[model samples]
Target: MSSAKLSRRRVVGAGLGALSSAVAGVSAGCTARSGPPRRLLLATGPEGGPYNAFGAALARAVAASGSRLRIVPVSTAASVDNLRELDAGAVDLALAMADVAEDAALGREPFTRRAAATALARVYVNYTHLLVPADGPVRSLRDLAGRPVAAGAAGSGVQVVAGRVLREAGLGEGPSPARERQLGLAESARALREGAVDALFWSGGVPTPALSTLSREVPLRFLPLDGYVGPLRERYGPVYTAVTLPSGAYGLAEPVGTLGVANYLLARGEVPEAAARELLTVVFDRWSDLLREVTAGARLEPRFAISTGRVPLHPGAVAYYRSVYG
Candidate 1:
């Protein structure tokens, strides 16, 4: 095996071991009825975004876990802004893109230095969707040139990936037919309805609520990432993946071919061991119920969530994973 693959396995094993030990310690140290629930504050997004829904589910999970968690809805644009909030200690937890989380910990690109934070869990993959009015002129990515495009909310990972996709499609250059606007999916959908924007690009999960609502009201068209997946992965590394947003994901006319980025729960380097243990239980144990509240929550299984931690897993999360998977 290649060195990278070998290294990945070793790290995973270590994370699994650490997580198991932590969970065991937490369980051994206190009885459920006697221990005081840890109070936690989780940060979410403004509204109508994946972060919002996912954060809500996480809060619910913590509550169900018999823990005291305050879900704080913070206005965020994802990536840089979210990481900044985390770094400044404005919140205890937040949903983040693994790509951005990686950069934040290392303090690279769009960030001045390493963020000193760590990964808690890999929650779900973010699929980028290019939605247009069914009867609108554009059909394919190539057709987006010089057309008005809403590139997701400003500072959002959606916008970042949208810009990358546009660049890959040769629309990022001078005098292109495409004009990229920064707006959330709901706002973009409204703009498309009003003919203010020709298309909307969002990097999120399948069946995104706003997109689903829009598809019901208007004829929606999906533009596939047919030929650009490999190139995107090459440029962005493992952060990009070829994912299909299946038909009916949002009452869509058909499935959308797209690229994806993984979402991760992030924490500061020194988050308490006891807190991490409890947090992990809330995430792994009640995943199904959590998913019912947030679609992404349902996808947070150990086989998937724990397998993709590129950075060092938080010792707390590590402890939880080890108990189950080790």
Candidate 2:
């Protein structure tokens, strides 16, 4: 990371420490016409998660676009927590999984109070990683019936989908057949290397740096999830999609079928229309730069931006698209 990038991330981390006292004032901030908001807090995922890197890239791009709207990217527990933060007025914007944004839109579990927010864009896709020891006996989801698994930490989007994968595989019940250990990507990778778990479910962008490092020691294999893509989408929403992890990713022997969920840029309903417009303008206008900076940004496409599941696109995003394609 460049010094400027490091400085930008530090600013976000510092802003996070001061947010508790600033929640009540988020809605009162400035706007595009009124000059710029004091700052826009973007709740991202954990340190090593894709959201963190992606959000940082976005923050930099928006800043460089000469927009007064400053996006401060902050580390968070991913989707569930980001929604809660949105509802709590602790953040103005966030990057969330499409499924999680849908859950909030419909007032589903983990979101008892519905958040008034909308998707700004369909940012990217998070591939489901059903990682196992290369030498282990596990070959597919069905084989994990009586084994140990790391289902990602609680409150993370990874955990939510991992739990669904287990339930759909018939491993959720029957005397706790699959003992799930709530672990984050880094911790889970560590556990896997130490022979502490039979398999781990990690949902992230391809070539997760931490996992790539772990793979160096433990050699790995992927358990396919293509069969569950349809079922997951039917049960959850349109966010679940089929994706193939290409061969050579994580040094795998061949491509692996998997479930992929769209990631979204979300903003509170209170955000001014012009502010939202300007922010997204920065995103789409300098998209190539964004893709070069954030690996996940490589998955962004305008065609898919409007199909952001139940969480409809913000008026600003729609207006921006209208001007371009119409």
- State the C-alpha lDDT per candidate: 0.69, 0.77
Q: List model 1 lDDT by residue over 114-183, tens digit each.
A: 7767777887777878888889898888898888899977667777778878888889887774788888
Write one digit per residue (lDDT tens) for candidate 2, span 5-46.
334565456455434334333334333235535478787878
Q: Provide the lowest-lDDT 10-residue window in model 2.
A: 23-32
Q: Give all candidate RMSDs, comma-separated.
A: 9.8, 6.3
- Superposed by TM-score, candidate 2 places the C-alpha of residue 187 at a distance from the truth, in angstroms, of 0.9
Instruction: Give the C-alpha miss distance for residue 83 in model 2, angstroms.
Output: 1.0
Backbone clash tally for model 1?
17
Q: Against the true structure, whose TM-score is highest?
A: 2
**Model 2: clashing residue pairs?**
none
Off by over 4 Å in 2: 1-37, 292-299
For each candidate, give its TM-score against the true structure: 0.83, 0.87
